[model samples]
Target: MSDKGLHKTNQNGVSRRGFLGRTGSILGAMALAGQIAPSQAQAATAGAAAAGPIDNGAHVPALVIGTGYGGSVAALRLAQAGVDVHMIEMGMAWDTPGSDGKIFCNTTTPDYRAYWLRTKTKAPLSNFLGFPIDKAVPRYTGILDAEEMGGIIVYQGRGVGGGSLVNGGMAVTPKRANFGAVLPTVNADEMYDTYYPRANAGLGVSLIDPAWFESVDCYQFSRVGRKHAQRAGFPFVFVPDVYDWDYMKQEAAGTVPKSAVAGEILYGNNAGKKSLQQTYIAQAKATGKVTISPLHKVTSVSPASGGGYTVVIDQINTTGDTVGTKTVVADKVFFAAGSVGTSKLLVRLKATGALPNLNNEIGKGWGDNGNVMCGRANHMWDATGKVQASIPCGGIDNWDAGGAFAEVAPLPTGIETYASFYLSITKNPNRAEFSYNASTGGVELNWQTAWKAPSIAMAKTIFDKINSKEGTIYRTDLFGTNKIWGDHLTYHPLGGAVLDKATDNYGRLHGYTGLYVIDGALIPGNTSVNPFVTITALAERNIEKIIATDM
Candidate 1:
């Protein structure tokens, strides 16, 4: 559908075109606050339009903060249940193409669309061959956000689709046995039998073809990884993803536009990957009762004098400046801003007395999901081919015995690195807490760097044995000189307003009647796998009950 068709009036008679004159920038205010090269600015200027806007002071039946997994699910279900919903996102809509004729830049090429409002890029792989690889870029409202909080860096997606736009599309579900630890309060059978399948179907999850997997040249790195794991007496499993496998096959055959094959995972994928924008968000838009306002940040939500709640929003430009402030009323508010965003907002609200009645367990249980990265110098005979696919299709499962499940991640450096990369999701027990700092008027997460020791130890249970078997050593040049483990950052940030502790079993905040926590903030610590699938399933389960009862 064209961008103009996305701005139709909803049931509440809110015409989005009325608010277009308020700002000159259409949709997301392209080109780094209108300071980019003329040619680049021209391309972004000729791109698509924004979502149906929710005008200032317009009342909404439901207001959802952040358009990640939980928010998307909530908006869709609520709209289906006869409620007009409006979603507020802090980042851009990401529906426009740049000078490169692509909505997103490649992983290897860091452009203005890479980092979020930063003058310099903060790539996860900071160093290569003992040299720093960070570069300067124009500060803008990009998609990926590398948030530095105290001792750890949490990488989150910043646009309307949230983490789905930047993630590797690994839709992994935890084992049935490990389900007990993931959400001990929720029923295991209902989740596995009903919600899990529903979430998977809703996400369009599918496995890679085994026949093509063994023959494809793009997946040569995964083949090498599988051989190494099998030789080391570890089980090698094919983890399903949300990437369009047929489209990937077409890319391998030179029959379509390349995305995953062109090393486009870190920033965003232009094609072949099924992000939330392509799935739930699209479905919600099709419902005609859901509208979204991009570049609008929800700063405050408190009880109103009449009833419901009052929400304060800041409309920002591309350079992160608040251009206008608007206050609206919402019958109900759902906090769906990923783990960090939701936790930080709630912590500040509680401390600043905007939400005085919030329970003491608001910011208690936060964790990094035991995310750790490492690389092994494979022998020259086992060359992980120069042509590699960015979407990972396999992993090493050691969770039952060693408390770790390692994904054989892609290097996609566009060259033969001769190194085996692995990102392990271990069973680390260290949990952090977010506290409000009165001096800075900001939230601080008390997660120490030393807390990653248990994660590193658990990850070694897989790499150490494989290294001992293959007679290979750890690669010291990838992360930094003499630094073997990438323990400073976490791609999977889970928890804060933990289930049953901060909220009820169904994610309703304890003290607030019309408020809810429906995102990864409800999951405690770890999900034993890539947590998006579990996050979606839990949202499906909770929102189903919520719509059936609350609405």
Candidate 2:
């Protein structure tokens, strides 16, 4: 890992030693087996029975590599296809309030190791592959080296749903022109005609009405953004978000009591937003098609003699402790672990020769959306007393030839009020250097901001776009600008095991078969919008081709 001093020791006090030797977790039909969602409980029970001894196959067949965005979609799709899918999540499942007193991990606080940190993410593929696995612990910083600290810290959620839980519930599919430009292989219009809406309804995105925004405290900040954007003459669209507008309205109305609304949502939202914990993964569970095995990390990928593959797992918790890993074999596998997770796993696997011939296109073209966040604020009163900054109400496009900017609206509980303007690159190809260090034998992310000359120019344009456009809350008529980069503080990351021009545009790892990266990791380029929708859509498109025809 390139981050040496960045990671603080596990604050939850779950020592790496305490986590390793703990095992003997067995669940029979009586141990809450009947409680599975209509879809996947049976698979959970089946996996439970087959999971006793690693190779014994007591339960947990059809290992799905992640429980995050793409993996969640894949698991549900496979499960609905009647494949007994075992989904692996490195972080423990959040304890949803149940009828009984049975305790689950409370993600709202650091009650268990899972809630110990403010920032979260995932990468433990499976226990089957050995040697050369990605790091499972969620580190706070990626590459802070000389980058400016900007507004609204961008973090990833680590637990069962990966970043979906921690994210602000922005359900983004970029503008038509922007989305189509990335996939040279797939027909952009055809994809829009086919996969985009399918992916949206799957994630449950709805519009934010102005009346609803009028009542919510967090949403009030967006009006400031709209005013500023209108002043700057930029097109500001009230975006569709995964966050439930009805629930937000209820929270604002005080009828729906919420700790989530009380906490302002950056660290984690337990009560309000409909993150994956409450949505697709939930539905996936209901489908009887998918089963989840939390705290198991993928070690490597090895070709089995039986014409399929084995995904080795580390079986560890968030505290860097061991919990006895497993090696499960799957006739078909999809790597949906996020960009960093999947890339490191595939790259290291290839480097150590565990799964050889991973092609020359394996670990290159890693980009972080050329992401930047900055703010422009002034102490001014709105009609409602003050403008509490909210998520993107609008953005500027013209100046950013290679990027786009959105006013990131953040409604902190009290006192400080600000909106975060996020700049996702429209055309950033600045590649970050990735190498496996033998001294530590881990992946190093030497992401230098200096490499992003075009993006830097675009970043300056976007922020200037944001600044030159509006000033409703400020005292001055003309906006003064302050620009900065918060390390690589972006939830959107692409590339690293990218689609090489040298390889097929389908993003084959060149030399590997029976191996396909189906997550955000396969997108070797950046987009001007949040990358998840595109990632999920692309995964849907890829899997449909792979399993339906390629199989």
Best by TM-score: 1
Q: Write the per-residue lDDT of candidate 1 for residues 1-551, one digit (tens) a residue.
A: 01121111112211111010000000000121122321546434422226655688988999999999999999999999999999999888887777767777767777877778898878777777677777777877878888998889898998888988877777787787788998999999898778887788787777788999999888988999999999998988888777778788888888877777776678787887777887788889999999988888999999999999999999887778888899999999999999999999999999999898889999988999999988889999999987778888878988878889888988877888898888889999999999999999999999998999999999999999999999999988767689999898888999999999999999999888999999999999898888898899899999999999998
Query: Could you tell me the C-alpha RMSD of candidate 1 in Å?
Result: 7.9
Stretch of 10 with least lDDT, candidate 2: 21-30
Q: Taking the tens digit of each residue's C-alpha lDDT, what string does model 2 give over 225-292?
A: 56655666565665556655556555556776443344334334445455665666777888866667
**Global lDDT for candidate 1?**
0.82
Model 2 earns a TM-score of 0.75
Local error of candidate 1 at residue 417 (angstroms): 0.6
What's model 1's TM-score?
0.92
Return the lDDT, model 2, position 464.
62
Q: Model 2 segments beyond 4 Å from truth?
A: 1-61, 96-154, 214-217, 382-394, 399-402, 411-413, 416-426, 452-456, 465-484, 500-509
